[model samples]
Target: MSSLSILLVEDDTIEVMKLNRTISKLNLNHTVIEMKNGELALEYLNGDHKLPDIILLDLNMPKLNGIDFLSILKEDNELKHIPTIILTTSCNQKDLQECYNLGVTGYILKPLRYEEYVTKIEKIVAYWSINELIQKK
Candidate 1:
């Protein structure tokens, strides 16, 4: 599969490190851009940068939570097509329903075990890399 530019919107330092570590361990060449919060993520998205093929979003954040961010992103003309998946620890059914209602591509619960996390990330990257993604001009 071809390399994918991934935008990861998360706040926790350990979570960010864990994802990076997992990617490295998997030997995948996907490019990962880290954002501390959804606000930063939106700023990056609106700027003059190549849009990411997919987004891994965290539900809980300090500024602009994932659900709220997803709402704004979906309303946009240029950014609406980018596949967005929730990579969060929240198993709250309400949160799941709300995210689906707002139009997320997928929602994955962060596993407690490191092995499980690696497996999940591997699948996520592999799936998106093989899919035909849009290139916004």
Candidate 2:
């Protein structure tokens, strides 16, 4: 299997660190590209760089929020194919509905416990990896 590439757009330094540690501990056969804000993420996605298989997007960000980013992404022909997952602290139903409406593949609330967070991420990675393989087959 090819290593999965993940683009993570999160603004909080603490959250970023936690996610980085979780990914490292999981030892997932994936490459993670990190960005601090939605605008920067959009720039990266629009550039000549290879598109990530999955995007781990945070809802609240500077310059542009996840909903706005998703709206733009869904409209772009070149970027519409990539799957985006909302990984956020908010569990608001309205936000969830909005994300689904904007075509996010998944929505995961940030876990308060470190162990739970790692476990959740692992499951997400496993599911996506398997799903991709099945699609190819």
Candidate 3:
């Protein structure tokens, strides 16, 4: 499979570290672009750099929360096509509904266990990767 590029918008340093290790262990050919908040993610997306294949976004952030970012992104025609997955600690039904309403492709709750987290991320990656394949056929 071709290398997948992902934009990860997360503010927690510990989660970031754990995700990095999990990615390495999974042996997936991927590149992760990190941003501390949704605002920085928007800047990167709007810049000249190539757009990532997918985005994993967190809900709570210091500047520009996930829902706000998703709202803005979905409104912009050029940016709306990119797939986004909400990876957040929030299990609130309202938040989940809002994310889906904003057009998020998937929503995953942050698992407390490392193994569980790895499994969830792998499943997400696998689905996105294979979904692209099926679409091309």
Which prediction has more favorable TM-score, 1 or 3?
1
Give the per-residue lDDT of model 1 (tens digit) for 52-123. 999999999997999999999999999988999999999999999999999999999999999999999999
Judge candidate 3 at residue 22 and give its lDDT.
Answer: 83
lDDT for 79 in candidate 1 is: 93
Residues 61-82 of candidate 2 have per-residue lDDT tens digits of 9899999999999999998878
* Candidate 3 minimal-lDDT segment of 10 residues: 128-137
Model 3 ranges off by over 4 Å? 133-137
Model 2 residue 68 distance off true place after TM-score fit, in angstroms: 0.5
Clashing pairs in 3: none
Q: Each model's TM-score?
A: 0.96, 0.93, 0.94
lDDT of 3 by residue, 93-122 (tens): 999999998899899999988889999999
Error of 1 at 19 (Å): 0.6
lDDT of prediction 2: 0.88
- The TM-score of predicted model 1 comes to 0.96
